[model samples]
Target: MHEVKKDGILFHRFDHLGHCDRLCHGVFTRQGGVSAPPFDSLNVADGLGDAPAHVRENRQRILRATGGTDLMWMRQVHGTRVHIAEKGAATGTPVADALITAIPGLLLVVQVADCQPVLLYDPRRHIAAGVHSGWKGSVANILGRTVAGMISEFGCRPADILAGIGPSLGPCCAEFRHYQTELPEAFRSYKGPRSHFDFWAISVDQLCRAGLQKDNIEVQKVCTRCHDDRYFSYRAEKITGRFAAVIGLSPPQPT
Candidate 1:
């Protein structure tokens, strides 16, 4: 991931996605904005107890940095439901966990504290998707559903899609408690006795199982919980801020 700073906002780009040309996407850090305390700097989740005005100002900073003001943000219920965001259909709706669209310039954002924010793009179909994959969403296979939705609704082939798994809680910090049967037996294949989970690996498996080529997937090595100086982790800090994984179609170049 390449970090680009513009107007105090930090935007991290996946090397696999190339430059800020046709496809634009960024994993925002907690470096720049005005929220103060726990939500200090660049918190985008408005309903998460952050003041509405502060959240609004923070969102404006992101919009200014990425040139996407009319960004579509999900309500993030941590479900497998994948909602398609058309040009105007996303303006005001019930919060959803994941969003998919072929609409150009309409940035699709997913807010995450400890959950993995997965970004998918089908260059062949000119479609993109943003998914919030927590343990629940992973158990429900939301990542796979995002790909399937793209294929079903937009004729997007999984092979041509490039995916980026943004920073989240890694196995090092994802410890589950006893008496917790929230995870199904299938998760046993990915977890060990240590009780920690490798969410990134799970996401990779889901993407591959959905038919995306292994080489096309880019996973950011950063762990939010471990790198608290650069990101916010819910597990690390009970009261933490939220970061955004924003993706949108780039404007056409001048002919």
Candidate 2:
């Protein structure tokens, strides 16, 4: 991933996705916005106890940075439900954990503090997806389900898709004390010392299993808990804000 600064706001872009002229993608950091400490600067999640006005301002800043006309956000229930975004269509926050779109100018956003935001782009079909995958979502195979949704709804071929796993809790800080009951047996292989699980690897493996090429996947590997100063981590700071990972197809350039 590459760091990009637009109008003083810092975000990261996946190199492969960045090269696609039709796509506008970014993983925003918790900086360059109007909000006090704790939720200070760029708190995009409205349900997190942050002031509505501050959250609105922070979202506008992101719109300025990404050039997205509309942002379709999910309620993120840590489930496998995927919402499809339409151009110029407005809707309330749906009770889902993932969003997919083929409409240009409509950004699919997934808010996260520590949960992984998996961005998927099908350059061939000009479709994109934003998935919010926490431990429950991961175990539920939300990543794979989103890919399948793309294939079914947008006629996308999984092999032609590129995935970017945004910053989240890393294995070093992901300790699952009651893993034997909480985590599935298949995830046992990723268990490390102190019962920490490598969710990054789990996401990669899940994406691959969904038919995405291994080389087409990009993992940020930046743990939100480890870099709490740069990001908002629920584990690091319980009463904190949420950052955003957004992806959308750009309108075709005028002739």
Candidate 3:
């Protein structure tokens, strides 16, 4: 992943998708905003007890940094629902954990605190999706489902899609004490030292199962819980804000 700084704002981009001239994508950090403590700066989720005004400002900063026209995201219920965000299809934020879209200039966002945010794009089909894959969502393979949706809904091939797994709770801090009941039996193998789980590997495996080439997937090893100074972490701070992982197809360039 390439770290980018624009003005005073900073964010990260996947190397696989970095040279794309028609893609606007970023995994933003908690910096360069106008919010107060707890939600201090760069918090994009308004529903998480942050002032709507601050959230709006923070979101605007992201838009300015990426030069994306508009941003849209779901309510993110940690479910497997994959909502299509094509132009003029529907209004309001849908209650889903993932958003798929082919609309140019519209950014698809996945807001997260500790949950993994996955950004995917099919350069061949000009389609993109943002996925919110928490432990529950990952157990259910929401990321795989999103890739499947892109294939069925937008005629996108998984092999042509580039994926980026953003910062989240790493194997070091993802301690699940009651994994025997909480996590499914399959997750036992991904356990790190103690009870921690390597969700990054799980996501990569999910993408591979969905037929995406391993070379097209970029995983940022930075853990949100471990690097709470750069990112917001729900486990580290019970009352914190959610940062955004955004992806969109830029408007067509003049030939």
Candidate 4:
């Protein structure tokens, strides 16, 4: 991910998906906004009890910077339920962890502080999905279900899908005790005694097992907890803000 600065707004872009002119997606950092400390700048999530007005303004700033409207955000219960984006459907703040869509211009977003924001896109079917996969969500295999949902609903071939795993708490910073054991036993083969678990690798493995071509997957190696200066990290700061990973089909060209 390369940091981009224009018009006093700071954000980053995925190099692997750079070829997709039909898509406009970015994983934003915690910079270029009007919020105060803790929330800092560009905190997209209203989850931290920030003023609603401030959140709205920050959201507007992002939409303006990205040329997107009406961000299709979810309540994000960290479950595997996936929803198809609808333009006119009554969105009752669905409890799904993932949102899939072939519908253009309906930007799908997932908020995260230390959790992974996974974006899935099937260029062949013009389908896109945004998933919020934290430790619980990962153990529940939300990543696999998201890919499966995109295939089942939009007829997206796993081979044709491109997935990106955005910044989050890396294994270096994601520590858990053996007794409580938040991660499942399947991760034991990939674990170490004192070594923290790597959710990024777990997500990639899940995508691969779901039939997505390994070459089509891109993982941003940046660790949110390690780079607290650039991103917001819940692990780094007990009460912090969240950055957003957003994706949607490009709008039609004007005649």
Reference-based lDDT, residue 55, model 2: 96
Residue range 1-255, candidate 4, lDDT tens digits:
677665678777677665788887888888887778889877888757887777888887777666555578899887779887776772556778999877667778889988999888887788889999998888899988888888777788999999888989887877777524566678876564586787778888999999998898899988998999999998888787888888887766678
lDDT of 3 by residue, 1-255 (tens): 998998688899999888887899989998888888899778998877888999998998898788678888689888889999967964689999999988888888889989999999898888889999999999999998999999999889899999999999999899999998999988889998888899999999999999999999999988998888889999999898888899998965669
Could you tell me every candidate's TM-score relative to the true structure? 0.94, 0.97, 0.97, 0.95
For model 3, the stretches where C-alpha displacement exceeds 4 angstroms are 253-255
Off by over 4 Å in 4: 90-92, 193-195
TM-score quality measure for candidate 4: 0.95
lDDT of 4 at 189: 66
Measured with C-alpha atoms, the lDDT of residue 37 in candidate 1 is 79
Please count the clashing residue pairs in each candidate, in the order shown. Answer: 2, 0, 0, 0
> What does the lDDT read for residue 243 in candidate 2?
94
Report every candidate's CA lDDT.
Answer: 0.83, 0.92, 0.90, 0.82
Who is ahead in lDDT, 1 or 4?
1
**Model 3, total clashes:** 0
Looking at candidate 1, the ten consecutive residues that score lowest on lDDT are 177-186
